[model samples]
Target: MIKLPFTLPSRPPVTRIRKCDAAQLRAPAGPRTQPMRGFEDHFVDIVDYIVRITDEIWMERAVGRIYDTYDASCTIYSSYGVVRSVEEVIAGTITTLNAFPDGEIHHLNVAWSGDEDEGFYTSHLGHSRSTHVGRSSLGPGTGRRSSIRFAADCVSRDNRIHTEWLIRDNGAQVRQLGFDLHEVARRAAEADTLEHFIVSPETRLEGQTPRKLLDLPTDTLDGWARHMFHNIWNLKRFDWLARYYCAAATVHAGGGRVAQGVRNIGALYLNIQAAMPDGVMRVEHVCHSEENDGVIVAVRWVYEGTTAPGGVLGECPAGKQVFMMGVSHMRFSGDRIVEEWMIFDELGVLVQGYRK
Candidate 1:
């Protein structure tokens, strides 16, 4: 037994876990510092860590900070696959920054879990609202702006990050940048003709396992995560939105996709089911936090189903099977949940579907 020091709900089918203690739950919510060479005794506030990641590492072009904040062997997992080593992360980081040189990422909120002993993890959901003025990923810049949403979960150890899982709204970016997804899809295939982008076997093994499986919800986050996957979503009871979410809640489903309030979010669900009536969802991993009054949860999940007759967007249903990997970040306020940020590989969905 892990001895979490908290009592879990015993409800039949789905049990809700109770909070550990008022005092512990209210423990220091702010950042703390730890001694580390070359870091000048930097505070371990994971939020601060996140700030440096965006401001210093990405925007400021302080590539050396990556080495300072990330362990030499840090591994990053994304739709593209697994990336290991600080050098790889540095190269990829430069590539992304090159794509959106003027792009600045803003954080809506963060769900943090774990301690330095086991490694700290931050489930950060936010907006990368910026313009495409540089020549990179999307090819030449259209000088157009894009407000892409992203969800990144990272684990830090030895005063540095060692693992990460990042999901972004690429489809929204391509479209907002005034480019056709099909064109990008075609280019992606051509670029990968040599299987150069495939995930390495070792990297695959590293990514398949999660580092710190904790979130901000103390105990109940797990129950909500489990219920959403096993019941509400799988059963397609869109009405359950009200039961699980706040009346004025916001749903940030990435790719510039958003729905406000329970009713509107429920409508999006309807549209989703309309596209993939037989969609099946599976929860690959769920991490929750226990330190704050509210819970921040990050869930790694997969959706698989064939397109319905109407299909998604304007495509006709050819019974083409589509699969997508999504990372969802939810913040709970009181009984019902408040805001949720979600992102998946929209480009991957189109590629997989159109290729068939």
Candidate 2:
């Protein structure tokens, strides 16, 4: 049995399990009679607390209560690439509230898994201000707002929040606030192309199979595979470097189509080269299938680039470079690519570079 640094809260007693004849065994009614709460319950409570705080800017109160109940310090890691202690987190919240009194946060969903004292929770949240003008500290402007579908992975200790990794829908937020995402993305793509155009000596095109890619250290391979699509898609002009993935396939979802397989992989490279002249791609993470077969692979990646005039997608003018990231799941057949499912931060890319 695992022991917590603090005493576990006693839940209301549940109905006792009734033993019946082997032939009459049935599920029990009401809550289970187990005296101890499981990891699931702990996770539920933490999620409930997060939901509550989002609805009402209860950072100060919630942080104190969390510290008291869990007997641990609370830290908040933000997607804006900022980390703060409970006190700083509360302060930031207060500032936001003061600047936009009507600002509110809406929690959409939370997906989590882990043990009672240690686990991870990912939640989607949105922030909005109904009135932007004449708000103290907030400059006069249209009452504009943005939504962010963010995810946070947190670790808990002694029932209190510990470490957290926050991820934000950067592209989505920008687009929602009336940004010209397409132009920005095009520009960024072009800029990235100009910056990292040369094929490196380390670049291997022919023998780069999924298994070979996976041959790197697990962490390195994982990162590369995750972002393979974005890198290949954004930097397609370097298709010669991706000869191994030329025959990759693709799968589609969410009303969008993703090209996969080796041939599809080639198409991805071709498309990027055709669409954006100067673009760069980066792989953030790659999650692999558990099957020992070297055929299937999946990944997530990010892209940044600048646009040149006469872009394949449209009349992308020079000047602005855009940055975007996305996730993809791919499957391979034999040594060739087979299928893929893809999603990206389209809105974020548009808004950051083109928002008026």
Candidate 3:
């Protein structure tokens, strides 16, 4: 099994993934040295490999492609549960496509690291628009159109993904589909046992050194991400929003909620903090790409704590601990972050908290 919460050695903060639009991203990679051997020849680079494979499997509706793109022993971890094996991945794909026949995901950006020799790790952000035309885990067809955000961090070798951490903005989808988020979670939790809700070792972060601004280097993307997450979220430094982000910065806080400006962004975060007063956030992974004028960084993080009653998540059972998995993509111009896409599964968190 792939180890969780492993730290990668820091590299000199130089350019990596490039900034490009959908059209540019899909354009021919052109002739270049293939970093990954044994990969498909059409994939000139790692980004192209990830984007194209995703398109082939999801958008193209080629469910069989999973057999080719994922290793037989691949495992997918998410807040709801773990999906093991390529066969399970294929089955899940079929089920999803069956529910939303017209579902299509638009890839926003990809931040990646590693090399062909060992393996490449990628954090891919996607925006999905779909209609609930058939029965699904959410229940029967509602014929409602839904838009949501999701992110996946994957490790690949020899043209096949071996492990993945996937998080979807499920609360957004449920609301768009006109379902009661809490009720849905409560029902699902009833069927599941308490053992499933226990926090895994991978999500624990107690007894660690405090991540102080002065102690952590901010020149590198890895350091910068750690600093921002620890100081702002863990330390409850709301004032740092202005100090770290641009005044005009925009945050896409999943479920179609977009907050513009530092004030609004801080408010979005405060809403969550209000629910879990003692929640602690820890960065599990970091990757970045340098563009012409700025940098784009992707951070995978986890938060855990008890929930207080009457907040964004509504009433919670006393002493109920919630574990949240999230992926955030930030675009930095100079020293300030100009844009961010914060994605997490609020629906899953509710289920975890409500599960008895």
Candidate 4:
């Protein structure tokens, strides 16, 4: 049984994260945060850099800009697989653009940390809308329009992105394209061309030395995030949801599904937990930024376990170990979460669980 939503009155006020607005984010170039020494002159800040480059590459049809934005040996771990080198990145982008033709990604929010010297890391939340007008890995044109949400975490230094972790709601896209999820997976498995690489926490943070924090932050958002995953997700403590979330909290879950209340949020959460009942969630990275309504927190995580019977994937347990990489952005209203946006590639997971 679910309990009534409760609040913590003794929680301290939020003050660390600086408040930002869309206008300021899209405003003319000027330094607002850390110094961007090697970055382009037009980029005001890291957020602007992320937002503009994406728009230029996707919307403006300037594919060549990738050469300037990404390093020569940049690596990208995606819902598909690991992408190495700028050439592969360029080719993939061209293929996607060719397929969609009119596809465009709108940047929703960017939660980031670090400096230009140590490399700034950004968790970018985006919404993409497009029409399948040309051929793609999914097959020939279906002439269907689809909208999905995606999250990408990128590390940048000296004006070039070095590493990135990207995940998209491929399940939602497949459904929107009017294809059977299991059928798609089976076909992909038969093709046997998919890399099936899982982006684990260690791979996401490879070769990066940890920097000591000079002054610890007072905000407990990080602690709250850990408790949500460890206790609620791992320990199956549903009763504790009310303590960390608002009664009317809304969750924009994977596959383009939205839950209106805390109960529905639990239902969505239960679906993933049930899929990998024995899976352990490992939080890879966490960052928060002040926004209009409250503080927005970004979390990158991986869930590893064997597939079980009667999960959301609509397939019985096959004893296949699956690693699900996901990213979630939570909007906190003071101490309690008011809204959450989570993105994971369910279609890819289904493919991973298939054996034929």
lDDT of each: 0.63, 0.40, 0.79, 0.77
Off by over 4 Å in 1: 1-40, 193-219, 273-276, 288-295, 307-322, 354-356
By lDDT, the better pick of 2 and 4 is 4
The Cα error of candidate 4 at residue 152, in Å, is 0.8
Q: Alpha-carbon error at 66 in model 3, in Å?
A: 0.6
**How many steric clashes between backbone atoms does each model show?**
10, 52, 0, 0
Model 4, span 6-112: residue lDDT tens: 22223212212134444454457554455788998887678778988898899889999999999999999865567789998899899999999999777777888
What would the TM-scores of all predictions be? 0.74, 0.43, 0.88, 0.85
- lDDT tens digits, residues 1-356, model 3? 32212234543332123444666666666664556787988787787788888888888887898898999989898877777789888878899999999998787777888988889898988889999999887778999999888999999999899999999998899999999888888887887532353573233359867545647766565776788888888778898788778899999885567899989988889887777777878799999755454567899998878888765576766577778889998887656788899998888888888775
| Residue pairs of candidate 4 with colliding backbone atoms | none
lDDT score, candidate 2, position 10: 29
Q: Cα lDDT of model 3 overall?
A: 0.79
Q: Which is better, 2 or 4, measured by TM-score?
A: 4
lDDT of 1 at 44: 40
RMSD for each model, in Å, please? 9.4, 12.8, 5.7, 7.3
Residue pairs that clash (backbone atoms under 3 angstroms), model 3: none
The model with the greatest TM-score is 3
Q: Give the lDDT of residue 290 in candidate 2.
A: 21
